[model samples]
Target: MDIRVVACDIFGTTVDWYTGVAAQVAALLPEVDPGEFAARWRGEYAPSMDRVRTGEREWAYLDTLHRESLDGLLAGRPVDEPTRDRLVRAWHTLPAWPDSVPGLTRISAAHTTAALSNGGFALLTNLVKKAGLPFDCVLSAELAQAYKPDAAVYHRAAALLDVEPSQILMVAAHKWDLDGARAAGLRTAFVHRPREKGPRQEADRPEDVTADLHATDFEDLAGQLGSR
Candidate 1:
């Protein structure tokens, strides 16, 4: 599908969240293996996001999710209180995937690239600034008071952008993420991030006949989008 704009997911989509998170934990608890610790922390992501998404809990943002998850991870560990707080805040300062900067720079030169993520506005804004991303907008599921898979968030982003869903492409790494975006009327572009599963984890990209395009990453996606 041809689209003029893309609403990207920031964490798993554009950043190596697992590694970034692991690095922070490793830095805090020198005795803990970074990979193992990071995995445990990242493991808490879906459940926390689900809490906010399902209305089981109030609308807690991703930052809260990260903090809660970090607290839980440090429960039996040797992390001190101050270091735990600092480590949790590291989510706001995650380093982007190595390809993110150049890939987005080229794509944004021709498309209205924005983040349509579950992350709160403040979190996303800080992330973009830290990553030095060139985004035209920062659209959050928080603004819609809902999460991805909730069409309300997508519609809210489309409305704010003043564009029809058909013209907007939802670029994401997860199949469920793109599925929700497609159901919301946006076109879908899958950017496969194999590392999102962590080493030896076997979940592959979802099988979907509806995705408009599938690429290995942002660079592959840019190649498929052709010209302006």
Candidate 2:
């Protein structure tokens, strides 16, 4: 493929959101099962995004949507305003996966690495900065007022990068994301993240997806792309 820009997904692809959010939940809501609460909170992600995607609501930042989800998930719980705000902010402080920094550093050295995520701009900015993720640029779906699986997000990324969609390699851990990129005419790379949803839930494997490349993690992805 004629790849130049490497657009990466952030949440599950580059960072360990599950562990991060669960830790916060465990700290704040000692009575609740942290892991289950975290999973339930994430379960609201898609439906919330769909509200905007389908024009049921106006464009809102991922943080706002996350807050809404958190509120709903904690309904009837003894969560205070401060605790709610802290939980929402947890997304901004997610830690990078073990191989993320090294892999992204190598890839950025060889290609124009960029973050292409549905996360809001501030959320993405905070995440990359906090985790020290090595990226040449950050592109959020907020730029296009749309989320992933919406062609506008991918097209906006290509336009911002000043590259043809085919010349941009969209790397993600989710099949739906890669499928969206593929539909938008971008090359796709699927990076397997077996524990993204936690140990009990099975994550997307290479066999479950179709892409130009597949790897166990970002380090393997860098090697596959021949990024030294």
Candidate 3:
């Protein structure tokens, strides 16, 4: 396939949300299990997005969804308004995985690189800048007013990048996301992120997905993509 653009999913695919949010949770709410809390908070992510996807509610950005989820998770806990807000902001400050910057840098040198995320534009901007991810562009669900796995989101990325969906490589650790992209006519790359959920928790494995390419990490993906 002639891939001219690489569009990547952000959260668990590039950044270590489990570790980052868990660390913040551990620091902010010492009494609770950080790992469990982080998982629970993330568990709310899809359902929250589904609400909007299914038209159960109006379009809301990831930060607003995160804050709502955090508030629900911290119910009856001692977390105050200020603490809750900080916890929500922790998503903005997440650290990229070891391979993210280097791999993205290499790929960006060869192809147009775009951050395709369910996150809001502002949220992605802050995170991408802070993480130093070498993406040529940032695309968000906010652009389509729809979340990922929605055909519209992937289509919007292709449109904004001025490429055919078939010419774009959609990369993500989650098979569901890849499936969505594939349905939208995009090529797919499944990058394994085994620790995204936590060490003890087994994340998406290669056997669990089917894609145009399967990689161990972003660096591996860059190599497979013929990136220097």
lDDT of each: 0.81, 0.92, 0.93
List, residue by residue over 1-228, the lDDT tens digit for candidate 1. 567788899988888777777777677778887877777777788888788777789887777788888887777766677887788777788778777777887789889999888888998999888888778889999889888878999899889888898889998888778889889899998877878756856444645435888888887777777632
lDDT digits (tens) for residues 1-228 of candidate 2: 989999999999999989999999899889988988888898899899999999999999998999999988878987799989999988899989999999999988889999999998888988999999989989999999999989999999999889999999999999989999999999999988899999877878888799999888889999999988
lDDT digits (tens) for residues 1-228 of candidate 3:
999999999999999999999999999989999998898899899999999999999999898999998888777877788989899998998999999999999999999999999999999999999999988989999999999999999999888888899999999999889999999999999999989999667888899898999999999999999999
Number of residue pairs clashing in candidate 3, backbone atoms closer than 3 angstroms, sequence gap of 3 or more or interchain: 0
| Model 2 lDDT-worst window of ten | 199-208
Q: Which of 1 and 3 is the better model by TM-score?
A: 3
Clashes of each: 0, 0, 0
lDDT at 41, model 1:
79
Error of 1 at 207 (Å): 5.0
Off by over 4 Å in 2: none
TM-score of each: 0.91, 0.98, 0.98
TM-score of 1: 0.91
Models, CA RMSD each: 2.0, 0.9, 0.9
